[model samples]
Target chain A: MENTTSNQTAQNDLQVLRTSSLTGALERELEHLILTGELKPGERLNEIQLSSRFGTSRGPLREATRSLQAKGLVDAIRNRGVFVRSISPKEALEIYDIRAALFGLAGRLLTDMVTDAMLARLNEFLDEMDEIAQQRDFDRYYPVNLQFHDFLIRSTNSSMLAQEYKSLVNRLHLCRARGLVQAGGLAVSNHEHREMVDALASGNRERAQEAFFRHVERSKQRFTTTLEK
Target chain B: MENTTSNQTAQNDLQVLRTSSLTGALERELEHLILTGELKPGERLNEIQLSSRFGTSRGPLREATRSLQAKGLVDAIRNRGVFVRSISPKEALEIYDIRAALFGLAGRLLTDMVTDAMLARLNEFLDEMDEIAQQRDFDRYYPVNLQFHDFLIRSTNSSMLAQEYKSLVNRLHLCRARGLVQAGGLAVSNHEHREMVDALASGNRERAQEAFFRHVERSKQRFTTTLEK
Candidate 1:
């Protein structure tokens, strides 16, 4: 009897551990779906459907949904269930402004601390982007561009800034701005990247920050131009 | 018989509604306690103790904690339970940098859109802060200073940015750098604010943003000086 009770206690503890990790993982996965538009805005989060789809039960899924709601990526309605939040163009531009802020800080901090090796890595990215732009292959260029941005984001001294930067980038996916990156825009964008790299190479924090901020400003302008067309 | 069964279902739904709302409220209340440092960093979150203290049950307390854990404000270790996160000086400075970035963006956006009435309100704040600075009164200066900052934070076009700016301010409470504000520091701080407002009044986006960013940079420097002392 004593052994059975002890084993049952151990099982319960294991179950608790399993459930918590599952809840966290499920939360992230659901957020990815929502942000990437796999789950469209206004789509109801049906517990029964999601549970079978994710191969989980309602308990952890509900917890995940609550976390998503807390993050402002979803809205929970009484009896109606949760739905992904939609982004307006104005809000999208606002997100871009915030990204510009972080990216500018990243460049400033990077200028103060960037090593020769880091500079070489950035130069290599610029070279790759130049070739990709020549080909007018935006599809091929997109991931490399993301890599370059992520590299700069990580170059910051703070992990919190890096995490927040990535989160903002994820939020931008909801902006419906992907198809707006045209071949001509890619070349112009690459030129701005070249100017940003040159400023970083100069090791002037003010110049580097301005170059970075202006690049984002130009990108935002390009986005607005596309929206108008 | 049909009426009785339907009544039972209605009661069950009401119970579900009550429990979920209770959980959401508990999550926010617990986050408040954690962020405000009432629950000190590294202190374990005792489910039983918290539930009894909150006059609720263990189920809601545990769910609230999981949400907090997801937010990086708290941590859950298997069997040992949840503990609040401890922040370092470097991380605090990084948070400051991020805030500076946001503040600068707020200034840039505000410059493009601020009305005369908005400018008047900011000037009024400057006057209030000036009197407080003359007395070299740190306590009196703090709230007005916060009002000044909060005013700028809300001036942005994005509600999301405003929400994020406030969240970052709350996280700074973990730094334990409050008593470091001196009477002399108050006067010096208002001088920077003076320059920032003057630049804002110029209505040049670049100038306003630079002034705002530099003010935070000086504030960060002041924080470092206090830390060293």
Candidate 2:
């Protein structure tokens, strides 16, 4: 009897673990759909269809959807259904403003905290980004640029800031799936990236913050102008 | 046949509306419990008990808890249960820094946009807050101060900013249930509020931003000092 109870408890633990991991995987897959535009903005999610497509039951699927909804990727409407959020142009611009503030905060935080190792990593990314920008290889430069900014925020060692920053960036990605990688935009953006690194290396907190803030503001302008055209 | 179909549709709509509204009420009630510290940080939520206590079914109760979990009020464990999130002091201070940045952004946004009516409303808040501070009426001052900040952020005409600001404020509230308000803290804080309004009225965007940012930083310092004591 004791053995049976212990085995049952172990099985229960495994089931719980499996459920949680499945939910996480499901959430990521759905996020990929929304972020990559496979599921377009304002497209209603069909629960039954998605359940069969993912080969999962409704319980885990709902959990995943709820998590995404919380992250601002999906909107749940009463009696209606969950739909991919369609961010307005105004909201997109507002998001940029908030992102600029976050970047500014990260820059300021990094001013007195960037170690030699951290500086070297940032320099490496700057060089990588510069090369890709010169070649106009957006596919490679985009992730590198993201990495640079991510490194800036993460180095602050503030989990809340990093979490909020990631969520904001994800929503912004939903704003422009392919991103604002125009013909000459990549080169100009990387140049600003260089300025940010230079400002940080100069050990001037205010200048670093301003550089990071302005970098995002310029990108916002570029995106807005492109979106209008 | 048409009458029957239309009646059925109406009933379905009513059911949906009731469910949604009930879930919303439940959410607010749960929020009240958490915010008031009745739920206590890190306390595991009992869904079965909560459902019965709220006089609702498991379905709507789950919906309510899920929403709160998304808002960062509650944390959902994989299999154990959801618990009230206990924020660390470090996390609280980091929250303050982000809040400062957000307030700074709101101040800058307000610089070129403050209307006479808006200025009048802000002035009313300032005067009311000053009076409450003098009277040492914290109960009255707390909500007034919150409204003042809410008005400040909302006046920027950015819903995304407003939403994120509110979320940050809520998490900050979770940091301290009784707040950082002390005997003389109210009066000193209101003076800073006056400076923010003056800066806004001056229409110098940079100064306004600085004033707002510093105001939050000062509050952070006060809160940390109080929390330590």
Candidate 3:
């Protein structure tokens, strides 16, 4: 009887771990959905529908909604339900301002911590970006550009900074579907990326900071210009 | 029958709004608990227990947990339950680095956006801080110091920056319990606050930025010294 109870306890622990991992996976999926604009802003999330769609039970679905709510991606109403958060123009500008500060810090830290190996990896990524830019492959280039920024942020080796940066970038991604359609911005973006990488390679902290700021400012300009039309 | 059906719909909508507001309040409470260290790191947050403590039901309690998880305050495992997040010395340092960058931005923006009324209000707050410092009332001065930084950030009128700043401050509060202990740092802190406010009042961006950086460095020094001992 003692042996059986011990085995049962071990089995129960494994089951708990599995469920937690499953919940985490579900949360990530929902995060992607919101960040990628699969679920548009202000769209209501029906738990029952989502559970059926994901082939899960309501338990995980509810948990995922809670996760998203914490991330500022969704708003939970008392009895009603959760809905995707809508970003206003004012909110967008505010987000960009904070992003600029974060990227500025990342650039400075990146310069301070640069290694030849890291530069080479950055160059490899930039070359891929160059090819995509030449082909005007906005779809493919967008994700690559994001990866480059992510790489630099992670390279800084500051997890807190990276975590906050990730949230800002995710929010920006949600707004990208509406903003990245600007004319002639793609080439400028690629050029900015090149300049930024050069600044990092040279270990010029001031220039690196400027380059990153300029890149974000240019994106903001593009966004505003699109909104104007 | 139609009247009854419409009434039911109205009731459901009301319930949703109520749930959202309740969840919001719950999030704030949980955040306070985590930041104030009332909830110890790695402590289990059982839903049933939390619900009873907060006088809420399981639904809102779970929702609050999700929000905290997103903020990196708590980790929820499947059948096991949620636990408060734990940080090490390395993580604490990383968080301080991020705070430096963020508060640096706030400083620059505060200089650029300073208004006459804001300066007056800041001066008023500074006088109060001076009085508290003279009295060696760290308890009163502690919150005033936070408000000085908070006021500066809010005056920038950048909600997103304020939100990110609040998060970093919350994390710092959790890590070291800064300003909670009765130390002789209040005098230096008051002097720094005066310098920061004066720099802002003068609309000298570079000076303000330097002062802000110095202020943050001083705080970090205090925290590190305390942690070392």
Candidate 4:
């Protein structure tokens, strides 16, 4: 009887781990859908439909939705269901300002630590972005741009800063305003990226910081102008 | 027959609500204990003792512990149970960098929007810190110092930035290093506060941002110096 009880306990633990991992997988899948605009903002998360679509039970699905709600990627209403969070214009601008500070800090920290390999990686990003900009491909340019900034942030070796930056950027995706995507500003944005890369190469902290600061400021200006129009 | 079924459903809903609220309350209590250092870093949370101490059942207590783990306040091991998270020297310094960025952004944004009432509130914080510093009271000085920065962040009216800033500062509380607390540097810290307020009053964005950035840099320097010793 004692041996049987121990075996039961071990099985229960295994079941718990399996459920938790399932929940995590669902959460990531949902986050991808929501962030990429596939799920769209303010759309209610229908448990029945989602579970059927994913071929999973309701238990792990509900857990994943709860996790997204905790991350501020979704909103749960009393007696209602969870929905993808929608960011207001003002909130988006506020988030952009916070991102600017973080990006500037990344550039400043990178000034002292920028090695040959880091510069080579940044050069490759700029080249990829340049080709994309020439084609005026927003879809391709956008991801590369994200990757470029992500590389700089991760290179700073500050995990806390990188995590905070990523979280803000992820939430910014909920702002479905087409005007704020810097659509036609590709060449200009790439120009600014070049300036930032040049400053980083110069090993001047203030210059690198200002270049990054100005890039985000220009993007914010474009966003505001589009909103006004 | 329908009324009897509806009554049973109502009873179930009430039970669920009661359990949820109990979990939320327990989570807040646990957060308070952990953040205030009452629980201490790396100490395992004793579920039975905590539930008994709070007059709660183990069910809600376990739920609350899971919530805290999600919030990065605690770490749950496979078999050893959950323990309050400990911030390492490296992690603490990285968090400080992020907080500095958020704080500098707050100061820069406040430059354009500073009002007379905001100035009055800031003056109150400076005065409180000044008095505490003169008495060499680190215990009294610390909370006031936190409030001083918190007020500035809130006054900027950026909710996202304020939230990010608060989270970083809260995690820093997990670092139990005595050398990093700026115990004897209270007077110098207050002096920097005066400079920041002065810059904010002048309505120069660069000056305000620089003042805030440099103040944090000074504190980080103190931390590093102490760590080296």
Candidate 5:
């Protein structure tokens, strides 16, 4: 009886661990759906549908929705349920301004903190990005583009800043997905990334900061110009 | 029979609405508890205890916990339950750096956007803060101090920046409660607020930004110093 009870307790513990990991995975999938625009702006997310889609229970589904709501990716109504958040042009401009500040800070910190190995890694990433841009393989380039930003944030060794930056990037990604597709934007973004990497390699904090700002500003211009048209 | 059915429907709807609002309120309360350090760093939050204290159901309680986790104020451990996040000194420094970047952007935007009426309202807040400072009432000054920051954010008319700033403020507040209890630090902070308000009134963006940076820098210094001692 004692052995059987122990086995049952261990099984229950494993179930709890499995549930926690499942919740994390569910959160990521929902975030990706919003970021990729599968769930468009102001569209209500049906819990029953999402639950079946993820093969999760209502408890975890509701938890994931709450997480997204806090990230500003989703908004919950009292009776209606959660919906993807929509951004206005004005709010988009504000987002860019915030992005400029955040990325600029990251650049400055990256310059200060970049080791020889870090620079080499960045250079390696940039080389791959250049190849992707040359081939116009945006499908491959898009993920690399995200990795470059992620690299800067990670190199700062600041978890708090990284967390805040991740939230901003998620929102930006969602907004960017709604706009008209710009083929040239990727190449332009690559050029800016090269400039940023060069500034960091040279340890020029001011130049790095400026390059980072310009990068975000150019992307913002593209977004706004498209939005206007 | 019709009346009874309608009454039941109304009750159900009301329950849903009440739960939603209760979840929000619980989130705010839990946030305050974390920010004020009434809930100590790394302390576990029991679901049953929290539900009873907030006078809510487990559903709303779990929902509120999820929200707090998203804000980076809490962390969940499956069956073990949620715990308030502990910010290390290093994490605190990174937060201040981010704040400098964010508030500097806000200050620059405020200079470009500040109207005469907005300046007047800012001065009114300053005056009230000054009166409270003179009385050496830290408790009364705290809320006013927060209002001043909130006012700047709102004045910028950037919902995105405002949202990001709110998150930064929440994280910063988590690290500040203990450090802020020092008399000298509190006085210096009050003085800094006065200087920031003056800079804003003069429409000196550079000065305003500098004042804002110094304000955050001073707080960071105090917190680090207190931690060391």
Candidate 6:
């Protein structure tokens, strides 16, 4: 009886491991769909279609959806199914406010912990972004700009904070596709990015924090201008 | 052909919904387990034991674990089972840094949106905390202080920001159980809480933001001193 019970216990453990791995993969797939706009905001998730496409059963897929819901990527309604969360203009602006504070905290922490090598990496992006800005290459500047801000947060070495910041950036990216970079905005934005590097290099915690906080707030302003048109 | 396809789709949809709700309940139960210390930190989760205890299958249990993982309450290791994440003193301090920025953002946002009624509610808590502090009732002050911070975040009316703030608070709660409140810490903490309310009432955004930001930083400092012992 003891051997049989232990054997059954081992079998259950493997079953959980398999289900966990499946859930992880399905979560990523669903996140990609929502983030890329393939699923579209407010579009009801069709379990049958997704299950067939992914070649998985409904059990794992539903689990994945629940995970997405926890991440704020999807919302479930009573009696109705889950749908990709719709970000309102007002909501996007509010997210920007939260992001600004997170960036500021990143700056404060990074300034305290930054090494010469870290400064060098940041400056490299700073130089590249400056060149892209001068060339009025908005498209190229966008991705480089993302890397610069990302590096700033990651430099803090706080995995939890970095994870939270990335989630905010992902949601912001959805709203970003709606608006174009304003005229001369690339130069202005890159100018602030330079200021951020200088502050970090100066090792002044307050200055570094302010520089990052204002940068995101300015970006929010620029985004608002696009929405007003 | 269309009728058959639609009918089959409906069946799959119901299955998904049933699974989704089951996963939701399981997620909450698992969260409660981790938060309540019933499942100690770094303790490996026994899938068979949990499934049997909850009277559910592994599918929903695994999904719930995934959700908890997303929330940073659980850790999944390759070839090993899930365990309650142990927050070291260092990780706790790092989380506090993130929480500072979030609370600061809440203050800044709340200052802009603070109605007369909101101010009244905040002040009531402020007064209650003051009384508790004078009584040297640290135990009573703790829960009331938590409510004050929660109300500050919720006042922003940004569901996304509020959700993120709540998650940070939850993680910090795990760390909080370790350190005891220092002598007269409650009074000092409550003093800062009043300053936050004053800044909000004054309608000074910068002051409100700084007040809230520094409050969390000071709390971190207090937490660190305890950990050093």
Q: Model 3 over residues A1-229: C-alpha lDDT tens digits?
A: 9999999997885676576665676788888888777898889999899899977888868877888776778877756788998877778877876787778778877888899999899889988988988998888888888798889888999988888888886776555335655446667777888898899888887678667766776777778888777
Over the stretch B38-138, how does candidate 5's per-residue lDDT look in tens digits? 99888999999889887777888888889999888988887688999876667778888898888877876787677889878877887787787788888
The TM-score each candidate achieves on chain A is 0.86, 0.85, 0.81, 0.83, 0.80, 0.87
Between candidates 1 and 6, name the one with more favorable DockQ.
1
lDDT of 2 by residue, A177-199 (tens): 33553545888888898899889
Ranking by TM-score: 2, 1, 6, 4, 3, 5
Name the Cα RMSD for model 6. Answer: 9.2
* Evaluation by lDDT, superior candidate among 1 and 2: 2
The number of the candidate with the highest TM-score is 2
Better of 3 and 4 by TM-score: 4
Clashing pairs in 4: none
Tens digit of per-residue lDDT, candidate 5, span A1-229:
9999999997885676576656666888888888777898889999998999877788888888888888788888877798898866676677888888788788877888888998889889989988888898888988788888888888888887787777776776656444544556777777788899899888887678667867887887887777766
**Clashes in each model (backbone N, CA, C under 3 Å)?**
0, 0, 7, 0, 0, 0
Give the per-residue lDDT of model 4 (tens digit) for A1-229.
Answer: 9999999997885687664565566778999999878899999999999998987987768757766765679886645778999999899899889889988888889999999988998999999899999999998998889888888889999988887888888988888774436997999999999999999999998788778877888898888888877
- Chain A, candidate 3, TM-score of 0.81
Question: Candidate 6: where are CA atoms >4 Å away?
Answer: A1-20, A181-184, B1-20, B181-184
Error of 3 at B14 (Å): 12
Instruction: Residues A1-229, candidate 1: write the lDDT tens digits.
Output: 9999999997885686575577776887899888767898778889999999988898878878877776667777766788887667888788888989889988888898888998899999999999999998888998999899888888775898997887777766766544545446888888899888889889998889889998887877877888887
> Which residue pairs clash in candidate 3?
A77-B19, A77-B20, A78-B19, A78-B20, A79-B15, A79-B16, A80-B16
lDDT: worst 10-residue window of model 1 chain A: A175-184
Local error of candidate 4 at residue B78 (angstroms): 4.8
Summing lDDT over every window of 10 consecutive residues in candidate 2 chain B, give the lowest-scoring window: B175-184
Please, what are the lDDT tens digits per residue for candidate 1 over residues B41-118?
Answer: 889989999999988888767767776765667777756788887667788888889999888888888888888898
After TM-score superposition, the amount by which residue B49's alpha carbon in candidate 6 deviates from its true location, in angstroms, is 2.9
What are the Cα lDDT values of the candidates?
0.81, 0.83, 0.78, 0.83, 0.79, 0.83
4 or 5, which is superior by TM-score?
4
Better of 2 and 3 by TM-score: 2
